[model samples]
Target: MSSPVALIATAKLRREDIDAFTTWQGRHEAAAATFSGFLSSDLIPPGKDGHDEWTLILNFQTADQLTIWQHSAARASLIAEALPFFIGGNTGQAMAGDTAHDTSVTGVTGMIFSRIKPGMEGRYREWAVRIQAAQTKYPGYRGIYLQPPATSGKDATWTTFVRYDTRAHLEAWMTAPERATLLEEAEEFVDNMELVRLATAFPGWVPVNATTGQGPPDWKTALLVLLGLFPIVMLELRFLNPTFSAWNMNASLATFIANALSVAVTSFVTMRLFVRWFDWWLFPNAHRPADTTLKGLILLFMLFIGEIGALWWLLP
Candidate 1:
């Protein structure tokens, strides 16, 4: 079977057009949903005081299905309708393989677009490999995905997606003197460059630190999610399931409702309360003491045990 494919589309819009652009994008997404093999889509807006570029990622079961959507009249019409809101024409590239379809990707991603000077593609590619190798030595480095311009000919823009474990770690590499030297070296082979930061993956699950722009690590976040979710699941299985059965609700419908409630409660209530109480542990300072970590783990463990004990007692 073919690997799943993700189409990454980017557009630049003026500040004044953002509201109108978002409305148009909603319609565009609605149209895309009707197409075959559409798995999911994520629209990432620019950050506060950040650049004007908006990114849309559409995941499809196969590249063929994505190609159909790309060439469909519905998409073309929507693109035309959206032209007035765009500062420039949009650009898109289809990415396949492991990195593109990596569902577990979290933290921050830097999308770097570089335009190579005429006749310098070969040399620029060699330099890209070297810079990627250099970046691997940095702390919290995840991986990088590179894509050349979707269409051939005069457009020589290369898109590079570099992911790091956190915003602080990403910024460290971005501002490092070694990277600056590499950028300076690329002056001969590069004509222009733009970098956009995307802090997505699991939005609204964990609040980012204002100063660091970093959230708790994935493992910590997952553990907290389990801490909140376990009781919710147990309670629903105990109380909600019986009530639904008494009401004669369809099995599928009950499952859907249960999931919706789980997500809503987890995102809005449980996570917010837990995050507030665990703020210090969640967003520890760079030099956080070992005891701080140990204490936080002990507290979390105790909470889990208490929840289990109470639920076991009450459920029966």
Candidate 2:
């Protein structure tokens, strides 16, 4: 199972009151633990954008857990204490929570895009690699992928990918001198630019074991068996014998009908087996601990229903 994740909740704060907000944040973390479903939290200050705002990224076992924390008295008190000093506004206003799909990532993937000038694409890539090498050398860098310009439209763009032990580490990386150099070198290629700090927390299902292993026992296998038998059964009941009277035909018809009925009955009986096997083998039901296992199980069951009932029809 992947680790359950949450978003980096951002809010702007006065630079003078940063110390005060930091202190309050520590207290809030302690207070938060008292609430049900608490996992962990981190404090991130403003980086290259050069603002006084700070961001707090939190993680929980599930959306239900976050809902509980939001309404907790401690959470209310903490927000009340810290709201007055923010610049981008308060947590309850600018901040919104998006549930994560990839529980593998502790926090969301934040991306910033910079475009290259017509002739500077080659040099821009050179600087990008240097920045990436520096970034990869750093503790939190995951890996980077660069998407060059497609044949049709705008110039090429550059992206950087970094992982953080905490959001604080990420914020620090952003503000570091190497990033400043990257930004400076980037200006040569860039004309009109855009930066986006995204939160990749939307939820979805993913397959578990794709390679050699005992796969899940589900209706997929049973359905395959039924499909294979369909042609053979039709031939046996309807076309095998050439000589037969009307009464003989009626008896033969009865035997054919009985065989079809048995097949349908067996498929219906094994439907649950299919669901259980698929749910267990496919989705990230084990990402959280055993105490939260039931919630994951329920989520997987819903996924199974959607897949077998709706998705099958929708897909080609």
Top TM-score: which candidate number? 1
lDDT of 1 by residue, 157-272 (tens): 77777777787889888877788778778878887665654343456666654333445677777778889999999989999999999999999999999999999999999988
Q: Number of clashes in model 1?
A: 0
Runs in model 1 lying further than 4 Å from the true structure = 1-201, 286-288
Candidate 2: what lDDT? 0.49
lDDT tens digits, residues 1-316, model 2?
3345464567776657755665565556556544455554545545444554555656565666777777777788878877786667446321234332223445434445556677765566456545554553344433232333333135545443345555655656666777766766566766534333421121111111211112323443444344334444444445443333443667667677657765664445433344345443332233435645356457556655654564343323
TM-score, predicted candidate 1 vs. hidden true structure? 0.40
